[model samples]
Target: MRGIVMAAPGDVRVEEREDPKILKPTDAIIRLTATCICGSDLWPYRGVERVNHTPMGHEYVGIVEEIGDEVTTLKVGDFVVGSFVISDNTCEICQSGYQSRCVHGEFVSQTIGTQAEKARIPYADGALVATPAHPDPELIPSLLAASDVLGTGWFAAVAAEAGPASNPHPDFAPRMRPVDYAARPLPSRSFDGAHSAGSLGVAVRRGARGGGGPGASGGSSGGGLR
Candidate 1:
């Protein structure tokens, strides 16, 4: 299948490579219907030393085409949405609603990302989430967004007390999406930056320091980490 590949810093190309197949008992192959470029993708697209030629996209909503022997919950032809950080969603962390930090969580198509027509999801049982049966067509966009960006944005707001979770109490958990007023453990105030890497930690910009506003924090200073 053809995928977006970052050959090196400052270069991106749509390339063809071998199609993925089941390699393990818990693996799955998906025929992606929706995927998009993430904001972080610019780091490599602008040549900031990603230094690998792997597949590119991650957020995906797709139809299952194949499943491994160990896969149980997912079946062929299931329409599903999977997180960018792939996890079994059944681990202690996942069970606690920290699916992004699943002990065995992973990101797909970094070099061979989800932007393509097909993808192989490893640890299928622990990673993918089935959308509601017979969802509305318009919901697909929101579902796809929930798979990553919206999830992250929503999570970010709660983590920083800007969304519904803004109780200002140290002991209360932050509210999460869909649930409206539901609270989860205090998420990092700064994901997408230092302290924690990947998609979990939010990073505050240097300039955000001058004012100390949450929005100012996540907004990049347009300067690389000092």
Candidate 2:
């Protein structure tokens, strides 16, 4: 398989690599239908983060080419969408909807580059969600977006206290007051609103590029089994 490799800052190349294989009983090998770069990938690319000849990319949508014996929820040829962070799904953190912080976690980008023909997905049953059927070509973009950016943005909004009940009333204008400014809010002030959003658009635009994006485009991919 071939994947994006960062040999050095501003040096991204499509190079051949060893094919991904199932090394664990819970692992699954996916043949990517679509994979994208994340904004986080740019950090290493821009020399902001230190790395050497590392694999890049994370957001992906793929077909299950193979699965370990212990993978129960998915099968060969299944079209799947997995969280950026792989989790056992049954872990305490995962049960509570915080799979990214699972007791045992691994960074997907550090493990393998998703911007290739195939990838090895750990904790297959817990990490991946299959579509009801093979998706239409048009839906591929939406499904691929759900792999990371959209999901991350939703969590960011929730973490920022933008709950479901918070709806934007027309004629609302955003302003930064002394109190609001002094509060030292999270994410950013511009994104905290009823109808306002940021991370999703930014991440989507970043992911749409050949290289993920231009900041810390890497992070922990998923939680591990106990």
Candidate 3:
């Protein structure tokens, strides 16, 4: 299958790669029909990290082609959407809807991300959500958003809302003193809510592109996980 590869910072390219094969007991290979770029992917592309030639995508919608013996709730030809964070969605954090911080979670390899013809998903029973059969193509982008960006951002927002930073103190940023872990986390929530919310704005923009009215362009009512 072909995928986007980043050999170094500012060196992203679409290239052919070896087809993925199962390497673990909990893996499921799926043939992706749709996938996308996440802003997080831009980090390494911008050289914030020393990343190279890793898989390039996380969000994916595909049909399962194979499964491991340990895998359940998934079978061949099953249409599915997977989370960017490799979560089993069964652990304590996952049960509380924190799949991104799963006890046994994993990240998709940078070189073999979701932007391909097929992908091998680990923790198949937990990492992916099955959708209705033959889903509408129009819903693809929305569903893809849920797989990673939406879920991760929501997790961040929820975390910030708890403890010293509740909704009541929405603007009450914590003072940054030495060891001020509390406030540090909340500001990151800025990215959390903003990133999640930013996409909704994009959806609204999509609506505007569809010729929706002025208020219809990339705002509260426009873009969000379908």
lDDT by residue (tens digit), candidate 1, 113-202: 898889888877655665546367787777676566544654544453554434554433344443442333344332443212222211
Give lDDT for model 1: 0.61
Each candidate: what lDDT? 0.61, 0.65, 0.61
RMSD of 2: 9.7
TM-score of each model, in listed order: 0.70, 0.73, 0.70
lDDT of candidate 3 over 96-203, digit per residue (tens) = 444445677666645348777888888888776666576888988887876665544433433444344334334344454333433334543344322232122122
Where in model 3 is the C-alpha error above 4 Å? 109-111, 160-185, 188-226
Q: After superposition, how far is residue 181 of candidate 2 from its true place, in Å?
A: 13
Q: How well does model 2 score by local distance difference test?
A: 0.65
In terms of lDDT, the poorest run of 10 residues in model 1 is 200-209
Each prediction's number of clashing residue pairs? 23, 12, 12
